[model samples]
Target: MTQEQWTAVDRYFTDLLVPPDPALDAALQTSAAAGLPPHNVSPNQGKLLLLLAQIQRARTILEIGTLGGYSTIWLARALPSDGRLITLEADPKHAEVARANIAGLSDIVDLRLGQALSTLPQIAAEGNSPFDLIFIDADKPNNPHYLAWALKLSRRGSLIIADNVVRNGAVIDQSSSDPSVLGVRRFNELLASEPRVSATAIQTVGSKGYDGFAIAIVTTDQ
Candidate 1:
């Protein structure tokens, strides 16, 4: 009924299903201590990402945001020893904090510091194998751009997930001047017409309040 209730139910389910980890708690603590916006996904959502990666048997992952590395830790743990996860962050302060949070995973975690707009192209230039899973959770205005890059960097069957798509139902306000809301609107429209992937969005409510994520599977190379 209330956001509080939603959050409580989420935490209850998480405590019952997910094992507690001190490192994850430490990541959030360090992020807050560093005065970073607690924009990271909730613990249940992070675990969902990990589960998706595991189900996909993802050997390569590309994450467009790395705020404090909270989700990064979860996703990284889903990878095999030889797998790699590259996360992009624009804020140097956030990246530094994330580096500390995920220090033990340095071998498999590649935290890239810079605007994803620029760094994504660099990743393309390097011409690595297609990513098995791609997660986009960065600046809202660039979501469509991130999705475009996700398509470019993916092969058939690759999973692409975008966070904060519902934006508390603000996505329906076509005239809203809020850049983030407008950006998600544009993205929804784009996804509706994009034929390269079969996509859908799922609305969710939890400790982070109401939001949603878009999950798509690359259906074709086109």
Candidate 2:
């Protein structure tokens, strides 16, 4: 199928399966007002997250970025009553907005204001209690580092989803050498080569653009 065709399919499936939530909508508006980068996952991506979380019955989820808690709300809402999500954001201003936006979800979401690299290692040192789901949407340059950390902390059956894998398919052009594109390409290579995980890249387009993502399921024995 053509790229546009695939995008249409993605839109159709997402629309058919997931509807927007008021809390998430409010959070997106708040993020926009705060002048933060539009880093929050798309609603379709949010639905994919929810579906993956529910599939794993994820009790503990770790997110690398929480722009304004829009995606966090989607993931948290999919969990059981006692399930929890810990999200990291480097920008304190963004974190502030996220905290405010997620105020009503105090029971299930923890917004950590700090570098994800630092936070992730701390979580790893704490016995690496195998996260059921790990979502990476932080600085693109740190994609490889994030994947390594996630692999160390994820269980055998955990799901790891990385956003912006295609980067408008610039990742396929090895000669471009852009940091973000190179980083995403490296991430895809690692996931493809690793015997511990099985993954597939799905091209998607929406408010983001002619881009896509990768969903890797950790399948190795612990």
Candidate 3:
């Protein structure tokens, strides 16, 4: 269907299912006021993440992106009081804004400021492996690397979620030279061939336009 139709349907569904919260609203407004890219997940998607984390009964979560901490808040809410969530953001400015947005959640959410590649190793070295859930939503060009780290940081039965895989359906273009497209293609190939996990992706459309999420569960230890 048309983008207009898709957006309308998404709005209807979100309005019906996801109630407005002041903190979440402020996070979006503050991020916009700070001129951050509007790359945060939509309300419905955030709710989906919450539900997924809850469904997995995740006591520990790792998020590879922290854009103003919108999605981070949603994920963190799924945790019990003692549960932990570690989120990484490369840009200092973005991290600063996210820190403010997630002020009250400092106890449950750890906002790490650095490139994911660099910080991921630190997380591993810190004995933070075997995260119950891992969400990868950073730079698309590094998705395969993130997937590799996700495997390293997760145990069997850990849930791994990657966003923006469809890229408006550009993923099927074998001749595409765009680094993001190439990376997602490679990531999908790796997922398909990897015997350790069963994975799949579904195309989605809404306020954010055409994209999709790749979801998998670690079926075996790496």
Candidate 4:
């Protein structure tokens, strides 16, 4: 079907399931007004993340991206009062907008400003390993690196989710020189070869067009 049809279906499902939230709407609006890339997750996708975090009983979360804190709010909502979430953003402008968007969650959400490659190490040094859940959605070229850090920061039973793996079904292109595609390919290969985790990716279509998420559960620390 066409993207229009997919988006229409997404709207129908969202209207039926995902209720309107003033804060979420404002986050989107502010992001657009600030000219940030429209890379935030769709409302339904955000709800899925929320449900997954809740099901995992995640007390600690690590997010590799914080575009405008749209998904951050959704994931943070899944946490208990004492729960904590650390989200990394490299762009100063995006981080500023996200900071405003998630201001209410200042206590629950830690927005780190720096390249994730840099900040992730600091998080580990600070003994923030064994996060209950990790979401990787930053620059695609660094997805493999992010996955490596996710593994280092996770424990057995921890859930790891990576977004934009499908890239409109371009992931299967063996000849693709696109850095994002190459990164996802390597990430998938690593997941397949790594015996410590069991994982799978599912293709999806919605307002964002064809894309998918790679989900994995760390099964062994050995």
Residues 44-104, candidate 1, lDDT per residue (tens digit)?
Answer: 9999999999999999999999999999999999999999999999999999999999999
Query: Once superposed on the true structure, which residue ranges of model 4 sit more than 4 Å away at CA?
Result: none
Q: Deviation in angstroms for 106 in model 1?
A: 0.6
TM-score of each: 0.98, 0.90, 0.99, 0.99
| Model 2 lDDT tens row, 6-42 | 6677678767877666788889898898898886787
Angstrom error at residue 103, model 2: 1.1
Model 3 is weakest, by summed lDDT over 10 consecutive residues, at 187-196
| Residue range with the least summed lDDT across 10 consecutive positions in model 1 | 120-129
| Tens-place lDDT digits, model 3, residues 2-47 | 9999999999999999998999999999999999999999999999
Q: Each model's C-alpha lDDT? A: 0.93, 0.85, 0.96, 0.96
RMSD of each: 0.8, 2.6, 0.6, 0.6
Pull out the clashing pairs in model 1: none
Winner on TM-score between 2 and 3 is 3
